[model samples]
Target: MAAMQNITVRGVALCDKKRAGNVHVELYEKDVLDPHDLLNDTHTNLQGEFKLYGEQDELGTIEPFIRLTHNCKAKPGCMRVGDYVVPTDKLGGVYDMTYVPLDIVVSGEGEQCI
Candidate 1:
């Protein structure tokens, strides 16, 4: 069996067409059934950027995913938070996940938010 190699994933989060800072971002092994299986957790910076690092087999690869959560539109007695998922292909080697947008929307009483 080959030795384990280090892998790094990076990306950005955006909500409502703007940078989403302080959002909870988690990285998990693909196909994981438990939240406890999370590999790493990091929050976006003021510029909505984040990075995660892990290890995988040199001969093989590990599937990774990014989950993002934000509460940019929550209100009293109402829930307008946002949840997003980004499943990534096997990272056989070090690579950049690049910038990803998680556009969130808020609507109520049949009225659209502008």
Candidate 2:
């Protein structure tokens, strides 16, 4: 078995029209299924910030992305606001994605405020 290395991912979730807080963020290896593929998940802080940590044998094998869920209490379903792929090639031992903007428009009738 190959040795595992600690990898950290950090980013901020921002909404162009909203406060951008309380958004759910999930990190997953692209094309992998749930339970085993889910590396880390967390909600954005008051300032729309979050961090995730995981271990992998090689950084290249971990094709990670941030899935943002906003307006979770929608009557029909939760909105998958954005899916941002982290550029692993630009990553060192630690990856800092800086800020990921989630711009979702809540239109139509009975659209609840986030």
Candidate 3:
């Protein structure tokens, strides 16, 4: 039988010491052979704070992670995307990211001008 697994994530996003509001954040279940499954998504509030809860039903463990997309510190027509992995043990509970900085450019991937 498939069991439902869930997780909660909360945090504030910042850029150059200022609140980065409206930042896009999404949770996903990683898949090796297919597209990753989106579990939950939200935009940071005006205060740059966000809390998200996501649930998935599966027969085995689900590998969860987060993806953040923002325009902080980007060029006039570009955006930045970053991905973070959630500890498997944190499933069925909360994972606090605390304060995250969006100004730091993601290495290698650079910025996407779309």
Candidate 4:
């Protein structure tokens, strides 16, 4: 389904081939994305195992999905969907695609939005 300006993506963190952490969905534009930008809503080690819900201008599913990027944090993992790097024994887990209903808290913009 083409969500035009908004979409919901559900995912989970796979560590040691097992789901270790809850999945997250963040809206970031490549031209202006940094680790610090995302660290605001959730807390996690550089390993990236957390969940967050934020609104972004879809801009049509920005490249190198945030899902794969977070998954690759487990040593030798790097956005394998499009930016896959050589796999290493650092963490022997894999990613899983799941559909968890994340209700949209707001459809319109909000004030005090960081």
Candidate 5:
């Protein structure tokens, strides 16, 4: 059997059509103060959907869950081809994660973690 350190995290990402560019996600414990994480580059994508998995450390401390949901909100006039992903105007993103126990079922309020 795998060691108790075998903890996994999984999730899906969705964004509006206006939101373009790639997305990134990282995991962390509930309380942590840091801009970077030990588990670097947990999530990355060139498509619309995003998923990630990682292990936990002692004290059950997982890396911070980071995400890039929005990008390239700027583009003067119009850029032809797939070159629409240009950062010039404005960009915003949301970051969150749901912790699930592998040993038991979890009851929640809503789907998508928010």
Candidate 6:
């Protein structure tokens, strides 16, 4: 059996350096053969700041990441999604991302029209 592992992440979501509120932030644990496990999720406050913490019991080290969904200057009826991975060594404590600018598309960023 494995012990429960935990993670804490906090940051501000911005678009062109301005606060981007209501952005959906999700924390997930990477899994090899199954769908990624959703640990926690929340929306940034009016200040564009968010804080999330989650825990899971796994046989191996937890590979965690944060996925952000936002409109951030996208055309109406479109949204952009980005994923920021956390270093495995950063688990079990707070990892402050500080600021995540949404204006710039990050690696693996995808756009969805809805």
Which candidate should be chosen as best, given lDDT against the real structure? Answer: 6
RMSD of each: 6.7, 5.8, 1.6, 14.8, 15.0, 0.9
lDDT: which is higher, 1 or 2?
2
Task: Mark the 10 consecutive residues where model 2 has the least summed lDDT.
Answer: 105-114
Error of 5 at 109 (Å): 22
Residues 1-114 of candidate 2 have per-residue lDDT tens digits of: 454545577877766734468888777666544343667789989988888876556434667666677764344654555566667774446678776656543332133333
TM-score ranking of the models: 6, 3, 2, 1, 5, 4
Candidate 1 on 14-69: residue-level lDDT in tens? 66668778977776655445443467788999998888876645344556655565
lDDT of 5 by residue, 39-97 (tens): 43443344434444434444543333333322222234422111011121211222223
Candidate 3 structure, TM-score to reference:
0.90
Clashing pairs in 1: none
Clashing pairs in 5: 26-64, 26-65, 26-66, 27-63, 27-64, 28-62, 28-63, 28-64, 74-89
The sequence of per-residue lDDT tens digits that candidate 4 reaches over residues 36-105 is 2231133333333443333344344432223232332332422222222112221123322342222212
Output the number of the TM-score-best candidate: 6
The better-scoring model by lDDT among 1 and 4 is 1
Taking the candidates one at a time, how many backbone clashes does each contain? 0, 0, 0, 3, 9, 0
Worst 10 residues of 3 by lDDT: 103-112
Evaluated at residue 112, the lDDT of candidate 6 is 88
C-alpha-based local distance difference test score of model 1: 0.59
Model 3: per-residue Cα lDDT over 1-114, one tens digit each: 889999998899999999999999999998898899999999999999989899999878989988888998788888888887889999999999998888775554356895
Model 6: per-residue lDDT, tens digit, 6-89?
999999999999999999999999999999999999999999999999999999899999999999978899999999998878
Deviation in angstroms for 9 in model 6? 0.2
Task: Give the true-structure RMSD of model 2.
Answer: 5.8
Once model 1 is optimally superposed onto the true structure by TM-score, how far is the C-alpha of residue 6 displaced, in angstroms? 4.2
Name model 3 segments beyond 4 Å from true. Answer: 106-110
Give candidate 5's root-mean-square deviation (CA, Å): 15.0
Residue pairs of candidate 4 with colliding backbone atoms: 17-92, 17-93, 72-77
